[model samples]
Target: MPDAPPSAAPVEESTEDWRRRNVGRLLNEAVRRFESRVLERLAEQGFHGVRLAHVGVTRNLDVAGTRPTELAYRASMTKQAMGELIGQCVDLGLVRREPDPADGRAKIVRFTDQGLHFLEHFRRAVVAAQGEMGENLGEERVRALLETLWDYVHPDGT
Candidate 1:
């Protein structure tokens, strides 16, 4: 009979250390890496200065123009932050601020033609990046992984 391979030594870790480094922490790190990879891919596809967060505004604008307050609520960002980002977008000619019909004092943010074009490009980039990732993980595993992750994030439908 062949001899069994030498047994590996058990590495001991403290309960506090293990708890301190749990799945939530690991998942957060993984998400950062995943977003970085996706954003890098997006830049290669002509979205030079865009990041993942831009998706929220672009999509929201595509659906319908919204006030800064509404966008902040939807995106879970501060109104000031949304305003600043909208200002930067306006400077880039991606979006515009137009007078709100209901409230003359309020301006709604709308996506420009260029912004729509960029949104389409962003969708394609995301698809391409996800395709690459799915290829690495395989379709079946990717589907299962997505389902598991979704379940973890939201017990019911989200």
Candidate 2:
């Protein structure tokens, strides 16, 4: 039989901690859990087919339609990566690609009629999830958390 791995020994210094958890990791985990809760609420409301991966497209998307480059910038992903997600959205009947009016060479990503409906569901899902979080963590705490994160994200409040 294979031997088990050695057990982790607690380190005296936090920097020497084996777990290696940190601020960025905590923030990433919180965002993921929040989105997962949103997805659960969406599914409970009879909305399906939407998945976490779609957030990269849907969350950054402008209602008036936006170019993939702008979406990538907003989502903090590569243009090519967002393009692949956009393709997935197209296949899922969530969005369509159209030639940009002013920029003939670029394409704009717009939601399909179905996608608009999905957007409503997405909005409701997020609110419901946030409500649950507020219930669990107290409304004041939730509000503070949102404000804190927003401040950190946009230090200049532009």
Candidate 3:
């Protein structure tokens, strides 16, 4: 093989320094912790069926409604996977698939009345979770971090 590129140097051993707790690991751990807290709050609100996986659908759901394919795209999932999740949500009475008016063959997934209520509860749960994070990281730091992440993720203002 030819020589490796300048940026392709072999990774060093993980010591007691930052290598052991790299950015990706730190971010993933923090997100899991945050999601766990949010799920706990949801459970407290009697939405025990809601899990972290459900967030992938709810987070990307449009206010009016959305197609399963669109939700899959937004959630970085496949249509089949999203369809299964949609079925699960429907079973839980969190959403319903209605015939799309614009396209007779297409279906639009919209939150049910129960789901609308759950959305309000979910919002409050998120606020409570953020409060907990703020308590740990200080209000300013947490908000700043959220702002940075929001900007980074929604660069197109979607």
- Global CA lDDT of candidate 1, please? 0.75
**Can you give the TM-score per candidate against the true fold?**
0.77, 0.84, 0.85
lDDT for predicted candidate 2 compared with the true structure: 0.85
Candidate 3: count the clashes: 0
Backbone clashes under 3 angstroms, per model: 0, 0, 0
* Residue-by-residue lDDT tens digits, candidate 1, 1-158: 96333223332464344433556665687677666777787678777877666766776664478888888888889989888888888876779999999999999998888888887777776677677768897988778978899998798777
| Model 1 residue pairs with clashes | none
- Could you tell me the C-alpha RMSD of candidate 2 in Å? 6.0
Question: Can you tell me which runs of candidate 3 are displaced by over 4 Å?
Answer: 1-19, 154-158
